[model samples]
Target: MLPKSYFDIFLVILLVPILNLFVYLHNSFSTSLSYLGLPYFIEPDITVDADHVSSSSSPATRRCNIPLSALLLRELLPVVKFSNLVDPPNSCSVCFKDFETEDEIWRLTNCRHIFHRSCLNCWMGYDQKTCPLCRLSLVPHDKEEMYNERLWRLCNNCQL
Candidate 1:
């Protein structure tokens, strides 16, 4: 039988290449994802718990420039069911998804650019105030102040 020292050396020799391959592949994958503007290490999905008042404050949905999403979409540019005539032509600018019949659609008033309802929600969740395609103000001129105020209040969590 081989000595204990020989067995340990053999084991280390076998493991060294495996560990090297792991590190090399990890770095290669991270490099490829970086080119696509994706994070090398992705955070696990975070779900809101009972402790949090809303999902907006949750880490998963936390955005640097948090806007009043509900107010903007629900009260300002309301979602409407997509129909051939009523909806705009072409795919959703935000998510690049095709608009289908019965899909909920949100159309910006100023530029009339259309997007999927959920796509718009996701965009607004990032606190983007302009159209994703044309970079036009999403809110109407008369409601700009009110939208900003709501955004500030919700982001700060204080009445203004």
Candidate 2:
């Protein structure tokens, strides 16, 4: 039989990558949970006894019923020419579909990145509530719809 040291070395070589993979997965899961705004540790209120179990209702048991009206708060408009823009974008960044002259578009008020109205609507409704390009929060801070014209000017200056 092989020496004990040889077996130990072989086991170490096989286990290191597996341990690293677990650590990576745990970290990635924690990061995603943070992005979703969920608490890392949730304390359960239910307790089990030898005879019976007692349970108390908590906010976690309730279903989240976000309304469609909430998602429609973002502004939708036609592509327009601003003094800051040398040339306007012709395509939707999310779906990679070309925009037509009369196509409706959604312009994020914060980052000023634009997308097709339908594409942005679907994206914000289901996938992510952030700008696909810069990962900025799409939710407006106030009820007022304020456009950041400086971003457009900066993009024009950079020729991007």
Candidate 3:
């Protein structure tokens, strides 16, 4: 038989790579299982009516529109001295530009964060309906509620 030291060295040489490979495989499997356990969002099913045949067979969900009122644009947004700002003093959060007296300042209703009127308008028009700073929904909760709110605002503004 081989010497005791020689046997130990041979065993160490043979087992080290095997142990490393086993550890690597175990870690890889654990990572894969962890990913698999994560929750995923699923879209609702679309159904078509047999009687009323339509050209496009797509799900019809009401789309929400941006509610831009004169009150919100003009009166709700008040210009203040740059020095008078409470937090994030003297700058628009959206544009990261210094607030000059001539610049139009608009504060978000939910988060109370201030931004430039032109910058916030552009952002709300194109990018998102949520607040840039707080991610709060600028519109009403549902499409129907948003529609009703818009109509109410319009009627009240028009004195109808």
Query: Highest TM-score: which candidate?
Result: 1
> Using TM-score as the measure, what is the rank order of every candidate, best first?
1, 2, 3
User: Per-prediction RMSD in angstroms?
Assistant: 10.2, 16.1, 16.1
Estimate TM-scores for all models: 0.50, 0.39, 0.38
Residue lDDT tens for model 1, 1-160: 8999999999999999999999998888878876876542443332222222332443333222334454344467856777844537878776777888889888778888888878877777776777889999888877878776755545465322
**Tens-digit lDDT string for candidate 2 (41-155):** 3323322121211122212332232222222334323334332333658678999987776666767777888787777767755736678899887765553333234223322
Task: Show where candidate 3 strays beyond 4 Å.
Answer: 1-88, 139-148, 151-160
Model 1 score (lDDT): 0.66
Q: Assess candidate 2 and give its TM-score to the true structure.
A: 0.39
| lDDT (tens digit, per residue) of candidate 3 on 30-131 | 677558852111222222222222223232232123333322333333555445556645677777888886665666555677787777777755636677
Residue runs of model 2 more than 4 Å from their true location after superposition:
1-72, 75-86, 144-160
